[model samples]
Target: MTRVVIVGGGPGGYEAALVAAQLGAEVCVVDRDGLGGSAVLTDCVPSKTLVATAEVINQVRESGELGVRIGRSAPDSGDVSDVSTDIAKVNARVKALAHNQSEDVGRALQREGVRVVRGSGRMAGPDRVAVTLADGGTEELAADVVLLATGARPRILPDAEPDGERILTWDQVYELDELPERLVVVGSGVTGAEFAGAYNALGSDVVLVSSRDRVLPTEDADAATVIEDVFTRRGMTVLSRSRAERVERRGDGVVVTLTDGRVVEGTHCLLAVGSIPNTADLGLETAGVATDERGFIEVDKVSRTTARGVYAAGDCTGVLMLASVAAMQGRIAMAHALGDAVSPLDLEEVAATVFTAPEIATVGWSQHDLDSGRVQAVGIKLPLTRNPRAKMQGIHDGFIKLMCRPGTGIVVGGVVVAPHASELIHPVSVAVSCRLTVDQLAHAFTVYPSLSGSIAEAARRLHVRGQQAPRKDS
Candidate 1:
């Protein structure tokens, strides 16, 4: 039987171990962070759970608009002020949920008969792995195939190190027992935006510092515009073109100095700069695996490295840094390595979501692709304010966008911005993956007074525009 050794217990490594074991391979997983890695134990799961609590607080604050009194008093009693979030309770719940998820993943892997080694793993040779056991011992294992999914950690700036008290990383924030009076989020990317939005909704004064002109610079421009407007309207201060140079403790609070010589004082600062792959000291050179300048593992579409019988996936490979993408890459690696039918990873069709007050989800091509003249397509955007369900829910800031081929009307990509947009983007993902046309999407039945109805409406509008265009005789 083939022997598979997976290094790291993140979504990629654990998922690959299951597939390899089910395929009749002897599988062993070396993990240091219990099970489920940072995605479950610290980063993704913990952050989302906190956001869920914040979402509840937001809903309760809007109870008056729904004609539903929130507290134990009449609507005119101004009971909204009574609605507040307990940071201690929220943090405790986040940790509990993350721990439960990690345990669940461990149970699943164990049921599949995959050996779990509690330690850090490194390449001893091309086909050998040396596990530095958690108990301070070492174990050498033989492998026919080795999968590297060591994942990544938060990128820290030299001048602005996290004290874990006043300054924090995404993973360190869960330990806070109290909410900050003024929270400064120093990054305008998805992580920064999510935390800023969540805190603002949970009754904290938030200031978002963005080096770029707008928040979510990498996302759809229109979606970013809507989110920025919402942030401003909800009392969150957005400082554009401001880059954090350093952070230091100032008497009772923290002070963040910008590159432009301006200082912003806050109760706490959260750094969301980016991440660095966990590839150093792993003996990659001895194993003959190649890496990029930034130390990210260099792998092909099938997650194969330069060395034979070696594969890499997840954030370590610098593919997309998304859990879903990591899982798919892991599965693809296992199937290809074990001589099963498989297809190469197609990044264009990958679906992604940003968890904020009004979540942003997208699949396939983007408006940037169209603007750059990389692809020929026609698109339309429909506001969520026009949707009956959104109006009922008091959600007015968001839209549904659809992009299709100008001639054939094949749905190539789409974006959704609204509450629960993550769940609404699945149908669009299917259309993009299966190469469905605008007519096909429009013909599908969506329930009335639903946010999903806007998806169909956008597609129908695109279909009509396609029909009206002049055609050339061949």
Candidate 2:
């Protein structure tokens, strides 16, 4: 049997191990961290669990609009102080959920008959891996194929290092004993925006510091505008176009200094600057694998590194850097290496979601792409305010946007901004993947008074035979 050794037990590594084993290959996975990497243990899963709790808290806070009451102190009476949560328990639950998922992944791999080594892995060569065992010695595994899936860690500024007390990284936040009284999040990207909205909803006096004109600068413009509006309306202080110079602890609180000679104080600080791939000293040179200047592995669509028998996937490959993308890349890497039918990674068909309040989910081309003449397509947007379910849920923000080819009318891309936009965007993803026309998408069945109905409505509005003419933006 072909021997496959996967380094790093992340979504990329573990998923590749499963496929390799199913293909009747001898597969071994070297895991330094837990089985699911940070995605399960720290990053995506834990953060989303926290976001889920934040959403629940936000719901209780908004129950006043629906004439809901908790005890004698009703929410409609503006008794904000009555709304509180056991944050320590919530965080504990978040960590526990992550832990359970990691355990589940490990069990799945075991069921697949994949050998798992608990250690740090290094590429000894194009066809070998050297694993440093946790307890004592090193074990070198000879392999016909080697897969590198080492993930990334949160980036911290030199001057704003995390003490794990007053300052924290996204991963370390789950360790907090209580919700920060005031949280100053520095960075307005997806990670920053999600956490900012989460903490704000969790009752922290949140101050978002962004070095851009607006939050989620890389997302859909109208979507970002809506998020920023909601943030401010919910009493979040957003300092836009301001860069954080340094973060320092003062007594029980922390202080953030901006380059523009301004300072902000908060109970805690979160550094959402960015991420650095965990590729340093991985013996990539010895293995004949090539990496870019930033140390991300240079891989083809089939996930092959420069080395002959070596492949790389996940954050290390720098392909979108999402957990789902990482898992897909892993499957492709194993498929190509094991001589199975393979399809190359396509960013256009990938769906991405940002877990902020009134979450933003997008797939394929964006509005910027349309406006900048990158692609020719007609688009239409329908607000969720008109949706019966949204009205029942008291959702006033968010919209559904659908885009299609001007002539062929094939659905090319879509964006859904709503509570559970993640769920609403799947059908749109299917349409984009299948190259379905707007008419076909509109004619699909969606339950009445559902948020998904807005997706169909948006597609119908963009339909060639529809009464409404093709418009640019909503």
Q: Please state every model's RMSD to the true fold in angstroms.
A: 3.0, 1.5
Clashing pairs in 2: none
Backbone clashes in model 1:
0
What local lDDT score does residue 347 receive in model 2, on the 0 to 100 scale?
89
TM-score of 1: 0.97
Candidate 1 residues 1-474, lDDT tens each?
999999999999999999999899999999998789999998899999999998888777755667767556466652255577889999999999999999999999989999999999999999999999999999999999999999999999889889898899999998988888999999999999999999998888999999999999999999999899989987999999999999987765789999999999999999999999999999999999999999999999999999999999999999999999899999999999999899999998999999998899999999899889898887888888888999898887899998989878999999999988999999999999999999899999999989999999888888745365322111
Per-residue lDDT of 118-229 in model 2, one digit per residue for the tens?
9999988888899999988999999999999999999989889899998999998988888899999999999999999999988899999999999999999989999999
- Per-model C-alpha lDDT, please? 0.91, 0.91
Clashing pairs in 1: none
RMSD of 1: 3.0
